[model samples]
Structure formats: structure tokens, C-alpha cells
Target: MMEDFSGLALPPLFGGHILETELDAAGVELTAGTTEILESGGTPQDIQKDTRELDKRKYQALSKRVKELEQVNERMLARLHRVQRLTRRLKKERRFLMKTLDTYGDDYRNAEITIPLEDEGGANLDGIPGGDDGGSSPSTTNQPACGPKKKRHRVPKEKERDAQ
Candidate 1:
């Protein structure tokens, strides 16, 4: 009858045994049985293949993520460039405005403007009071520039109203 060797500890090469002396003492009989089971199961080779496949999938996913990040970086760089260009343009415009103000600001503020009068039926200032034609002063005029003042009617106090 064949003994059940399934529960027996495996050798160090198969990731089971802890001691080298135990592995060496296990001898050819146990090694042969273990080899037979390993060959039939194809476990080690399958595990290596599966690990390689998983590594390939992980590498592909990482590569895809890298590409996405690179695209985002490129877009951010483009937006940054646009902002920088606008900033440069605004700075240039500000400089130009400052230069213009430095050159002509005082002149514009202190310049006096005179309008020549046309003689074509415009209002005659000669007949008006306080005119340059040497008319009477504004105070000597009978009527004031504003209308005459009106007299105010005062309201009675509370005690005066009760007495009335």
C-alpha cells in the first residue's frame, strides 16, 4: 500500500522546509515523491508564468498612467504660458501708460482752454448787468439773481396749542 505523503514537509527548494539538516536527511525517497507531485501539478512553472503576466499588466497600466500625467503636464504648461504672455502684455501696457503720464500729465492738468465767441446773433453781454461793458454791479441791481425770499409761518408750541 502507498503511504499518504501529502502532509509531509516539503524541501527548502519548494519554500516549505526550515532546516538544511532536515532537508538533507529527507533523502532521495522523499525528494523523488516531491518531484513527482511537482511535475504533475506544474505549480512552480505556472506560478512564474502568472507572475510574469501580472508584471506585464502592471507595467502597461503604469505606462498608461504616465502618459496621462504627461498630457496633463503639457496642458498645464500651455495654460501657464498663456498666463505669462498676458502678464507680460499687461506689464508692457502699464509701462506705456506710465511713460505717457510722465511726459504729458502736468501739461494736461495746467493747460488753459479759451473759446472764441462768434458774432452771429449770440446773446449780447453788453446790455446785461455786471457785463464787461461797465454796467452797474450785481449788488446795485433791483432784483437779485435768485427770487425774493418768502416769510416762514412758525408752528405754536404744545402748551400754546392746548391753551388755544
Candidate 2:
């Protein structure tokens, strides 16, 4: 792994690179994590023979750590986006529920369809099925719309048993 002392183009390990921070010990805050190809001509094997094993282990550990951090950060970013969307959905649902309560008052009971055609207060909070323009008051209505009872079709016992 060597040529006769011709410098800058040959090294113990061909195409050797050193971490930038290792090259410049001072003012390395800006150049950390960058690599610089070796240019020094001395036999790097002879100069730093003893530390190669240690450096190899450190490189493997650092590479694994970088991959691990990248995966965890990616998952966290995905979860953050999901949480943001959920927060927006919840806010919109809350606005809808609040508007429903304000327009109709606390008139609902166990999901009943008995919407009041008139209330004592002036606000016409009738949730009229098709005629609701969302701007009508109680005085605008000529007749009260009584919610019709839901018609239930009873399936025959023989059909129910067959479905089961």
C-alpha cells in the first residue's frame, strides 16, 4: 500500500479520506461531518498505524447512528403531520357542533327528530329539512313543519333467519 515517498498522490490506503474536523482541530464548528481527501505525502500507515483499528470501529458506529436517527426523525415527522391534520378536523367538527347547538338550542333528545317549529325567543332555529335557507327567522314561517315519523319496514322472520 505504498510508493517510494512521492507525496500528495499516494497513501497507505489508496484514495484515503479524513474527517474535516480531524484535519483542523481549531474552529471546526462549521466543518464537522465533512470529509477531506488525504493530500499529505507521508506514509499514513507509519504515521497513524496504531489508530486505524479504533477509527474503523468509530466509523461503523457513527454510520449506524446516522441511519437510526434518520429513520426515527422520518417517523416522527409523519406522525406530526397526521396529528396536525387530526387537530384541523377536530376544530372543524367543533365549529359544526357549536353552530348546530346555537341554531337549534338543546332541543335534541336521544337523536330524536322532533325539531321545534317555533321557540319563545325570536331566533327561528328550525332545522327545516329542505326549505332551510339558513337565514329564516320564526316569523317568516307561515306554518310549522312537524317532523314526520320514520317509517320502518319490518323484514319477515324467515328472511332474517336466512340472513343470519
Candidate 3:
């Protein structure tokens, strides 16, 4: 009976070969040849495993970077909030200072230095020589001696008086 090799997917039966399985040097040579083929086939699988390992490393690095960016974003948000609060406080202080300057009009100087607004008697000075205690200063020499004027409200005349 002729054996159908095409239908048999298995390797040739090792027992059917009359050749010696172990012929010293010849056996070693055949085994070495088979091992070389198997080693070549293993290369593609190794390359695939290496590619997967590289991809996993890249993903871990990107994840670590994202976490660092999130931490930076959180710190920036906190700083922005603190700056907003400080800005609000500075604005309130500026308004209060402006109101104070308006109340002390005429006695306020445009200089960038802080000068006392009151004397020993707690009276506002008008920067004039002989104006308060008769002491003369350079700022008082060219300016007139004028105290801050009290704001006044004029009441409307009565309707009967206007008619008359």
C-alpha cells in the first residue's frame, strides 16, 4: 500500500528510517542542524516580545508625565486663587487710602514719602510758616496757609419764600 504523505501532516515516522539514530559524530551533527533551524524560528518571537516590552515602557513613561502635569496644574490653580485674594485685599486698601486722602484734601502732598498730618495738638497743618506754631519750612514758603474747608450743604429755600 503506497502511503499517502499529503494526507499525513505528521513528520516521517522516526522508527521507519533504518539509519542509526546515534552514529557518534553524525548524530551530533544532525542534532546541531535541527537546533540551528529552531533557533532561527525563535528570533521572530523574541522580536515581538521585545516590541511589546518597549510599548509597555512607553505607556508607563507617558502615564508618569501626565501625573506630573496634573500636579503642576493643581499648584498653579492654588497660586491663582491666592493671587486673586491678595488683589481683592489690595483694592480694598487702595479705596480706603483714597477716601482718607480726599478727606485730608489741601493738606495732602503728592510726594512719595509719609509725613505726619498732625502736630502736638493733633491739628492738621497747612504747610505754611507761622500758620500753626509760627515755625517756617521750605514747603510753607511758597504755599498759602489754608485749612481744610468743611463741606457744607445748602438747604433749599421754602416754597412760600421762593414764591414771594
Q: Candidate 3, which ten residues in sequence have the lowest lDDT sum?
A: 18-27
Give the poorly placed runs of model 1, Cα more than 4 Å off. Answer: 1-41, 106-164
Pick out the ten consecutive residues of candidate 2 with the lowest summed lDDT: 28-37
Tens digits of lDDT, candidate 2, 63-115: 75457657867888998999999999999998898789879876544565756
lDDT of 3 by residue, 27-120 (tens): 3233444455556666777757655654465455546545765786788899899999999999999888888988878354566777675445
Count of backbone collisions in candidate 3: 1
Candidate 2 vs candidate 3: the lDDT winner is 3
lDDT of each: 0.59, 0.55, 0.59
Question: How many residue pairs clash (N, CA or C atoms closer than 3 angstroms) in each of the candidate models, in the order given?
Answer: 0, 0, 1
* Location of the lowest summed lDDT over 10 successive residues in candidate 1: 11-20
lDDT of 1 by residue, 1-164 (tens): 44554653332223432233333443323344444655676678775665565446545554654576578678889989999999999999988887897786555546698765534344454555443443446675677768889899999999999999
